[model samples]
Target: MPIQTRLFVRFALGYLLLGLVAGVVMAVDPAWRFLWPTYLHVIVVGWLTQLIFGVAFWLFPRASRDRKRGREGFIWATLVLLNVGLVLRILAEPFDLGRAAGPLLMASALCHLGAAVGFTANIWPRMGSGR
Candidate 1:
């Protein structure tokens, strides 16, 4: 697999571990129920989505001759943005202390949206022209 694919897989595995830990914590103590959303997002977005992205990037058809895997820089940016957004959400959501975390949550959501756009743009052309 490509280095990027490996990195993304590793990230997914790490998130999976974290999600499991969060699950255990929630199971052990009802007071920690507030972390349910965080655990769910970590598993879904961090683990599953990242794994899909990595596998898709590796398995998709090649880019045109002029481009390498359809703009490697954008892929890198997507990776960074996705992680940053997840991290922001994980940190800010729990400590929201009510409404004080509004800006942080918005920023996190925007970053995640940006990552989705970047990933889509990077992969769209690789779908090929019915060739």
Candidate 2:
């Protein structure tokens, strides 16, 4: 598997573990129920979506003989943006850090959007007929 694929898969697994732990904590302490959004984001965006992205990137048809996958830079950017955005969200979401957190959360949302765009741009051409 490509390094990017491995990185994505590993990160996804880590997020899954983190989400499960968070869920357990919330179950144990009703006070932590406020973190439901954080746990959901970790599980869905960080784990499930990332896993799908990685596997799809790997399983998708190649772009060409010379360039098997699409642009490497885009893939890298997608990985970085996704992981950074998720980390930022994990830090800012449940803390209620007021104004500072608002910007961080916005930035995180942008990063995630960028990741989606990057992934789409990189993978679109590969979705064609493998002539």
Candidate 3:
């Protein structure tokens, strides 16, 4: 399939995997509270969010190929930022990594946010199906 479609389904499946892994970890080891939260966020925000956004942008209508905003660069950039943020968030401890990783995490979140907004703006106008 197309890059957008791949990203969409790929992320969703990845999120499902992540959720399963997280659930297993939580079940086996009850010491990691952060694990559950981090896992959910990673799946929900990281995988699921990107999956949905990428698919929307991919499937969204465009007047022409030139007008198509679902370019490769946008998709990669969004995916990269989202993964980076999610990885950092999941890797770090709640109390630790505060000194350095916190800012990076924030930056990552911002990047994803910007990409999401851009994705929406790029495709929303193209979609004239309803609103």
C-alpha TM-score for every candidate: 0.92, 0.96, 0.77
* Cα lDDT of model 2 by residue, 22-118, tens digit: 9999999999998999999999999999999899889999988999998889999999999999999999999978889999999999999999999
- Give the top-scoring candidate (TM-score): 2
Candidate 2 residue runs with Cα over 4 Å from true position: 129-131
Cα RMSD (Å) between model 3 and the true structure? 2.7
Q: Could you say which candidate leads in lDDT? A: 2
Q: Write the per-residue lDDT of candidate 1 for residues 10-100, one digit (tens) a residue.
A: 9999999999999999999989999998899999999999999889888888897677588887788888888999998999998755765
Whichever of 2 and 3 has more lDDT, that candidate is 2
Ranking by lDDT: 2, 1, 3
Compute the lDDT of residue 36 as modeled in candidate 2.
97
The C-alpha RMSD of each candidate to the native structure, in angstroms, is: 1.5, 1.3, 2.7
Worst 10 residues of 1 by lDDT: 95-104
